[model samples]
Target: MPSGRLPVVNPWRFETNQATVQIKVGTYYSQVWTRAINAWNSKKVFTFKIVKGPAQITILPAQSNEASLIKQNFVGVAYVNHDNTKRITSVQLHLVNSLLKSNGYTTSQRVNVAEHELGHAMGLAHNPSKQSVMYKTTRYVSIQPIDVKNAKDLYSIPASQYFINLPATTSTTANKDVIANGAGDRLFKSPFETRSVQALVDPSTIY
Candidate 1:
């Protein structure tokens, strides 16, 4: 809302200001997720609750294929799924541990990346300012006042305005991918590129 601050991914927040989360990563990385969650929770603008059963948000270590995308410099990616009404249904957050380790990211730096991905899960778009946790590329920064204000602005919107009408033939599901590059340069994949992580890293394989 402030000058130079990016807006939220409009109308993409969960039904309420809070959502259930389930972390499927290892113990060490689980702690990282917890710290990131706590940071956002401290803002009191939004809340992420850890749950055992099905959850609206699921955090996990990157799969073999997904982890391989790290070679392109992406350290994390958040895949957001929504229902026909445009309400956020579930979010799959994959933390690419392989890249983080190979790049020698410190624990705090890893938490920074987690916070960035969580921001995406909360429907916050990337802020061009490097000081915010929602920066397009993950840096050593954590959540800032601007980030909190953005979340507050998003949740403050009335529930009635959250849904947008769609065509009768619209699919029941839709997805959006938000990626974080380790290099801190361009973070999103080119739309013309193939989805295969291996092909993305090795162009020769693409036909």
Candidate 2:
């Protein structure tokens, strides 16, 4: 049940039952955020969809906090996966214009930081390399390469993996390996799922 956020238990990943991120922005920055997420997901097989429309974004009075971030968390800090109903796994925004200026990143650079952290909200972990959007550090623009690969890997975990029940196995080499060892629930072909999925695990669900 623990998401990837718990580094001590499950490092390099995290998940939310759900999250509702309020993307606080100015009119111009609003456009920038949309463009960034679009470009970020364009190269990947998975896409992060906005849950609903007519969203309310919060744009607090900006303050100075860049130096504090670097010396402290090394990234901007926000509540991670703290949604009561929808878990907002992460959030970030420029606090003080002067704070970013103090740290030597432009407005665009600050947006990159925001985008990178949003990527984390979407279940990405920090990558050490500059090539990744998940990369811990960027030159101030462009999400390099490794960032996309890591995101894909995180996204590939099948729904079944979340639970303890294993299913039919597949081969590794020339022979199909029975990795599940027949201990899994069942691997019945589809179309029967709606009527008989309970049978897939146990027949008790059926009256």
Candidate 3:
């Protein structure tokens, strides 16, 4: 992976006041998964809530004959941060929506996707790290660290700027970002922060 940072030259923000969105669910349902998905969306918004009577479900053309893995229509869909305020369209995974419950994953997988897509609609791009919930691939059935971090970032910036965060304006010459992150000893660690080895390992980095 590239050691260089993706420039945060601009802070991310969007018009969230009275933001409106439309979620289209294709012809498939995963009641348990859908419930989980909805539950998760309810929490994504920082200042707003999913608008009451605003969430609409649409049953559209879907390739249902395919296996759950192959199914391309839906498990569920929602909007990002779309309360009575800001909005973005969100969608669930292809076919796994209904299939996950049978395999013991259940609603968690749908919850994961709902969180991720909503993350995107909220203006976050894919996080390349495997540790992230916003990673391009769905490796689990629940929210991960990346999910919380990015979501925090979504609301961190003030609404008026909507384009840049404050940190970028500071001179790195006087305020070295690498030196600061290095202070945290951000060396490689397992995706699971609570793994036994990590628990036993010393966090101090050796120069």
Best by TM-score: 1
Q: Predictions ranked by TM-score, top down?
A: 1, 2, 3
Candidate 1 residue-wise lDDT, 120-182, digit = tens: 788787676768787766557899988888988787777777666653123333343546433
1-207, model 2: which lDDT tens digit per residue?
A: 324432111122234222343455566555555665566667763454443333212222333644543343233333232222222223333333443455566556656765665555555545545555444454355665555555555555544463234232322233222222121111222221110000011111122
Off by over 4 Å in 2: 1-21, 50-75, 82-96, 163-207
- lDDT value, residue 70 of candidate 2: 34
Superposition-based RMSD of candidate 1 using all C-alpha atoms, in angstroms: 6.9
For model 1, which pairs clash? none
Give the CA lDDT, 0 to 100, for residue 46 in model 3: 35
Measured by TM-score, how close is model 1 to the native structure?
0.77
Sort every candidate by lDDT, greatest first. 1, 2, 3
**Predicted structure with the largest lDDT when compared to the true one:** 1
Model 3: lDDT equals 0.36
Mark the 10 consecutive residues where model 2 has the least summed lDDT. 194-203
